[model samples]
Target chain A: MKTLVIVAHPQLADSGTQQFLKTSLQNFSTVTWHVLAPDVDVAAEQALLRRHDRIIFQFPLYWYSAPALLKHWEDEVLTRNFVYGAQHELAHKELGIVVTTGDAKREFVAGGKEDYTMSELLRPYQALAHKAQMSYLPPLPIFQFAYLTDAQKQALLVTYQQYITNSDFTSFHGQELWFEGQLKAKIDQTKGTSKQQLTQILTAVQDNREQLEELRWTLSLIKDNEDE
Target chain B: MKTLVIVAHPQLADSGTQQFLKTSLQNFSTVTWHVLAPDVDVAAEQALLRRHDRIIFQFPLYWYSAPALLKHWEDEVLTRNFVYGAQHELAHKELGIVVTTGDAKREFVAGGKEDYTMSELLRPYQALAHKAQMSYLPPLPIFQFAYLTDAQKQALLVTYQQYITNSDFTSFHGQELWFEGQLKAKIDQTKGTSKQQLTQILTAVQDNREQLEELRWTLSLIKDNEDE
Candidate 1:
């Protein structure tokens, strides 16, 4: 599916985390990266939205929401007749948010200093999605990007790729199947030991899926016994 | 107390509710009305905040939060060192939100289509206030402004006046005292019959305060009795 990542930061070029995240998506030919400018072409933006199957708004959490630039873009680009009313040009398209926060993920909870979850704070976007009849995906929150280790960054890169490209990243079974399919595709293209390694990884993924199904069945049986 | 109302609506001139609200505040000499422009003066904006005891960010709710212009004002005007850190210019000042929503008040709650309370959605502003060490006042949300009856609009004018001008508008006892004080001052400035009418209203206000105090005392006694 075609993916659009709209990055809205005042100083995006200066931001290391945002730069890294942008660079990680270089390999995805289907992903289009759009950065906000002071003066935006409204028609061009609308056209971009129309083309993308999945629309991701990526920005640092400024005052618990998007920057003014993004907000302005929304107000200007998403006009009533075209985006909302009878026409509803954006219906059935997927909407996602990739928010980077300066605070730790733990701080965004009911009893924490922030005093609310990211989901609660980001409800406006979800409401927007609902209004447009679009599928609102769960937000991918990258917390304390500056403090993350190299390994954590690598893990985040993989997750970010999945979030932007993979339609069913939220489901474990779906994600495993997607990864296994990737390995299966690579097995025929690779040479020598690399092909063998790809086959081995695909076999392991299939075996793990079977084990997970068994575990789920056992848990369901236990629940049934308790119900009796 | 000097009150500053920062109005941030892109189409403020066209909005009937906002225009009426603006007209209502003409009597308050201490209340400075600042309408945000496309290009804002950062230093002058900071100076206005310095002059005002209470700062109210007034705007129509766009995407469940302040409009882009207001967000831009915050992003540009409220900066490090000036608003926070060592200098902390905004500390001890009261921060208020005056938001007008097109949706009905009932729609903004748990299990409703909106799926979140106004307070929950506006937490980002509250958190911003916390960060700046500013006292965050309860937000004044004008719901379904277009659908409000004339009588409801009149009541809203009174409440809005109190919110902007009265230092302790949120407190019942404080509001009573303020109303009583206003009547007392008006009595001095009026003709014989008008003076008499003001005196009578002041007496009623004082009597109500006494009645409220008695009710609170009786309720506390019941609680104490239950504890025993």
Candidate 2:
């Protein structure tokens, strides 16, 4: 599915999180990065939205909501006729959010510093999705991007890519396939001794994926037998 | 209490509700209508906020949230330190909202056309109030202003004014006192037969107030006797 990442930040040039996300999605052929601005051509933006299957509203959370630029974009591009009118232009499409927060992720919970879940805080978008008849995905919240270790950053990059590309990202099996594709792509670009090591890793990943699939099939078969 | 109404509309001049509200509060010297712009002076805004006992965010609902201009003002004006830092600047101050929607009021409920309550859609503001240690008053939603009957319009005017001025607006006792005060003011400004009519109405209102107070006192006395 084609994904459109509409990023809105007042100081887009200075945000490290936006930079990291931009760099992470460089290899994604089916993804489009759309930066929101003060001036919006509503018709063009609406056309762009129609072209994409999944739309991602990516932003740094300010006051527990997106930056005003995104809101501005929404106000301009999401006219009533286009959103909930009789034609239902955006119906059955998917809506996702990638929110980056300066605060720790752990603090966004009951009795924590924020005293609210991320889900509760991001209800406006869900309400919009509901109104537009779009499928709302669980938000991908990246908290304390500056504090994340290298390993965590790597994991974030993978997850972010999958959020854009993989339809079954919530499952481990889908993630395994995503990782395998990345490994295969890496192997294609590599040569000599390092390529051999990468191929072996790819083979092991494939083995794991096949075993999981087989187990799932066997479990379904057992359930069927029980029903009989 | 001094009320600061920070209004944010992309085209404030065109909004009928803003005009109505502005006309309604003509004689209210304690209420200040501060229109938000793209450029914000954070220190000045915070100082203004500090001066007011109550701060109101007045805007038309854009996609179930405030217009982008309001969010822009919020992002610029409400700095982290000024709101929730060591000083606790806005603590105990009242934060109220004046949200105008073109849709029917009854449509903003569970299973209604809007499918979500106004309270649910406006949680972001409440969350901000919580973070600042401010008291969040119930939002005043003005629905379908164009379609309101003349009587409804008058009621809306009174409610909008009371929301800004009256401390106990949710209680019938509070409304009775408010109407009494309003009637007295009208009586003072009038002459001849009209003044006499207003005075009679005021007297009748006062009598009702006394009766309610007497009933409340008797109920409390009965409770005390029960305790004895």
Q: Estimate each model's TM-score.
A: 0.90, 0.93
What would the per-residue lDDT of candidate 1 be over residues A134-158, giving only the tens digit for each residue? Answer: 9999999999999999999999998
**Separate clash counts for every candidate:** 0, 0
Per-candidate RMSD, Å: 2.8, 2.2
Q: Residue A39 in model 1: shift from native, Å?
A: 2.2
Off by over 4 Å in 1: A185-189, A207-228, B200-228
Q: Supply candidate 2's per-residue lDDT for A187.
A: 98
Q: What's the CA error at residue B22 for candidate 1, in Å?
A: 1.5
lDDT tens digits, residues B19-110, model 1? 99999999778899999987979999999899989999999988777889999998889877787656989999999999998888998887
Query: Which window of ten consecutive residues has the lowest lDDT sum in model 2 chain B?
Result: B79-88
Interface RMSD of each: 1.8, 1.0
* Model 1, residue B57: C-alpha shift (Å): 1.0
**Stretches of model 2 off by over 4 angstroms after superposition:** A224-228, B223-228
Candidate number achieving the greatest DockQ relative to the actual structure: 2
Clash pairs (backbone) in predicted model 2: none
What are the lDDT figures for the candidates, one per model? 0.88, 0.91
